[model samples]
Target: MSLRLHRIQRFVLSVLLFSSLVCVSCKSSEKITREVDPTVEAYSIDEDKAIDRLSEAIQHKTVSLEDTTEIVYDQYDDFIAFLEKRYPHLHQKVEKQRIGKYSVLYKWEGNESNLKPAMLIGHYDVVPVSSGSDTLWTYSPYKGAVDEGFVWGRGTLDDKSGIMSIMEAGEYLAEQNFNPDRTIYVALHHDEEVGGVRGAQRIAEHLQDKGVELAYLVDEGLPIAEEIIENVEVPLAMIGIASKGSVNIELAYNQDGGHSSMPPRSSVIGTLSNAVNRIERKPMKASYRGLIVETFDPLIPYMTYTQRLAFNNTWLFRRIIKNKLSNNPATNAALRTTAAKTIFEAGFKENVLPVEGRVIINFRIHPNDTVEDVVEYVRDRIRNDRINIQVLDRARNSSPVSSTKAMPYKMLKRTIEESFGEVLVSPSLFIAASDARHFHDLTSNIYRFRPIRARHEDRSRIHGIDERISTENYIEMIRFQIRLIENGAAEL
Candidate 1:
């Protein structure tokens, strides 16, 4: 009988141990789910009127030129007046102030004075359509043609849509007399394409002088990326929590001039060319760290079985994962700093051996590295005492990485889920710079998101030929802005 009791006890203990192991495995791989609002209503707009307003705004030709003198100030004035005429209610209801000659700031007061305000920012500047690419476009670059369900133009996708959606949301709220418990600030910067020094920077200083602390700031950035990952087919909404830095380094080699017929064994051009080739061949080391790792963590659960196995066991598959990510240009950029040689100057005539040769390389720095780090890496790779390096412009460091656990982030996530059902949301790093980078001093909660559906095919259209946005997508953008404003300002 004692032997029988021992057998039964052993069976029970084995079962309990098996159950505990299963529970632990389940807990380790659990997927996070958010509670979403099922009946969140979409905001309505006058479709024809909205499209007409956008078309008119695009026709104004408020293009940002590298040389400020080239910009037509009259066009900017006309665009501002057009905004006032189109959205009279917003102008009358909100206190408007012009900063830095052209940037517009609108303040909407709330009942609660103690609550910090929320900010919505967008830039109106559009990159110039390259001189020779006009023939490639299906529609006129500045005509703002609304055809076959797309509003086609230079500013359509780059950003005029972003600012217009914000204005439409504000006009809707103001017309309905919707009062909030927190203040709201709308900043429309005019010079973002050219670095935003005069527009966004001045706005930040003006707000700082007034002693204002923001609850959150939202700017134009990552869209609802469709089929972004290799094995993940679902649409993913990427919110940019930080941005990379930028630096321009000029590498120059100077030697005594000589006739091409009597060139030295290594001329200035030859040495500089060799340095460029070496730097390109030996790039900065790419690693899976910082925001890139954070971005991939939540995606594991949704990946295909093979992908899931590979991602879940990163210790064993680290090399495989890095190799796969490095093969693609987009993913490769997410992995490390990238170098591009943009400008190169040598002898004006082929028969002359120039005394000086220069190459300007631009680097988009990863958050893990700094300007000094990039400079050191380049110098080490070149290893040529003859090459003199000069930093041509002010180098910017990586912006502070905002926390994913903050209340503003939570609110932003919930609003996105509520607006677009059953989509995966992830915190990502913005590869490009935006106006929000200037507001790092005011708040730690800066989010970069634009609620437009973007796919791989639409990649080249941005700042390229055939730039456009679908009319339906524009409506969705308006709905998203309205939801964000309503939910983001609600009392916690």
Candidate 2:
């Protein structure tokens, strides 16, 4: 009987020991995860000062255009002087260079050799403000006033924010006396709103000539948004990994001129219009099997169980995913290449039948696709040999995929993760063009990320009236930029 009791006691002791071990293991894991700095605390940004600076920037009215006939009120010179005044500390420390009449470049020399440098790019130029719409604005377009959490004006969101953030960070680093290992270049182009012939492209050419192969280039593209992820509303910081290539094709057809009463079987206007209709009907197929879809896979773990299951079932999810993306204009843009018909010309006068008519198409090509493929696809769709297709301009596809593995991207993600707290960081393809294209050959990895939270109303103001960024987001943006430069510089 005593022996039997000993056996029972030994078995109970064994079970208790196993249970204790399991509890300890789980506690250790939970503790380690809690220690990891996934979410950065939110700090109050200096909203008033940020708005004042943004407002002052908008007041300059630096309209970029191809017409070299300068506007009498053109304020490029004044803008340069403003930068010199605002960032006096930066001016004293960093090496600054002025390219042409307006473009600016700054270098913070590092300890390493000058083989590969990481470049942070932004432009100061803004599109001309549309006239005769004073009442459309809640505040004057140039007023830069902070009302209801936003700093309103032109260039507030487009790019001046990028320039401000970089300078703010540089100034802070100088104060901290922090030095990076690799050389860093801050290139600001003067003509991004217009084509970048004299501004960014020329800058890239000069850098290439100087044998400066860039480690990576960071530019402007996507923004951070709160409470919206796959319709679930999580904070998301979208970094643009690549921009689609652009091609302009002009289609023209000729018909013999004649009196309006006596017309040919098919007029030039009719044929041109028919070609456009056909091209539109047979739109480019949207495909999601690429780097873009892959980037979002990491976020699946953070989603709800239903969402996780939906994400996991690739076979069941493909059709639903495509449909969901097609439903939203913004999501559609991020997933596919887009074709827009910008200009069309047909008749010289109403009374006469024109001899020639032309239509121009602008295509934003996806990274997996090429300009040749786009043109060929359009040519095949139109199928009318009488229509002449001529290429106007083509900005060739960039080489790098803007890897998340790169030091700058990792630093950006880490900084954002700390600052925004709960936001998920993901990369996508940016539809519009930016100055980053010029640095494709020089920089191996390039991305576009502005760390600010924006909404539908904020996005509408981007080339429209009362364009503004949140005063709070603006200050945090500056802090994030300072952190990125400081963090990225350390690895160099």
Candidate 3:
């Protein structure tokens, strides 16, 4: 009986040891965030004057229309003139050139000519309010009303705020005689809303032709997400290290037309519907590993106990985590390539069966996948010799992931800490496309971050109606830009 009791004790001890080990592993995670002293001093600006500048800029109807013929070129010109009138110091300090149709590039020469330059990118163009949606806004969409402690308008958030902030910072720096060891280039695209084909692309080519390789480039993108992730209430400063590639695949089916009474079993509409259904049903595989792991590592420390355990012990809970993440549209997009069927057209009349049906599927390619991979994905999924598949124009491969260890990334991280004080910083995959995609070959250290403090509901306001930026957030953006410019143009 004593021996039996001894055996029970041994078994109990073993079970306890195993449980303790499991607990330890569940809490283990490599914290990659390094606490560092800020490199730039806190700078103050005239808040009212700064807000006025952005508000006035937003008042301009520099809307980007799909058909360039529909655009009012005068508004674009007025915007350029407004910059000259407002930022006299910047105009005097830098050499400005017009590229593409309306894009502007400013070159601020540095003391050290040998050092590679840093580029600050932004787009002045804003998306147009949908027809009959104007009444939905509390303030006029184009009025640039400074009410409710926010700059109420179309461009305030989706990026006149970015343009105005950079210009404000650059003008202030130039006025302060803050000469840098490296050159600074400010490239503002006019048509980023449509695709930046004319604006950013032209500037990139012009820079490439001049053999202008940059040390780094910063553009507008992911922001300081406040309460975006559940259970992690702390704000996350997510820098877009890379943007997903975008391609619109057109799938068309052509067949003989027939009357509605004698519908064929395999009509063009049915064939096209089947193809789209198949593509929608089988989305590209979700990738919870690699960069995504790196993206969420910094936030793991801020998660609740259960959340932390699940994230930390992904080996045992990967499927559970994946299911949870996949359930949400936003998180799901981050983990995988997304195929959205944006346009589907079949019969034009009620009684006539359409001879042709066309479906356009726009896929945002994952960082791991390529444009070719997506095309092959669609082709294989459709598996129909009769259907025609063609890739539309403006198709681009995903930007190569920039290194988090790079000096530019680190400097930007330091700048964020200096500007926002306490915040979680991480490099994330930008699910949406941005003007930064145009500069992939120009620099390896391209980071897309706008530094705007955003909540979950604030997202729809970007291109949607009632777009606005809080007065406080706008001021912080200016300060952030100032620090970013000074830090970026400083010595390595």
The candidate maximizing TM-score is 1
- Give the runs in model 3 whose Cα sits over 4 Å from its true position: 1-42
Model 3 worst lDDT window (10 residues) = 27-36
Clashing pairs in 3: none
Q: What is the lDDT of residue 31 in candidate 1?
A: 40
Task: Locate the minimum summed-lDDT window of 10 residues in model 1.
Answer: 23-32
Query: What is the descending TM-score order?
Result: 1, 3, 2
The TM-scores of all predictions, comma-separated, are: 0.91, 0.85, 0.90
Pairs clashing within candidate 1? none
* Regions of model 1 farther than 4 Å from truth: 1-39
Candidate 3 scores a C-alpha RMSD against the true structure in Å of 6.2
Q: Which of 1 and 3 is ahead in lDDT?
A: 3
Residue 142's lDDT within candidate 3 is 84
For candidate 3, give the lDDT of residue 260.
90
Instruction: Return the lDDT, model 2, position 254.
Output: 91
Tell me model 3's lDDT, rounded to 2 decimals: 0.86
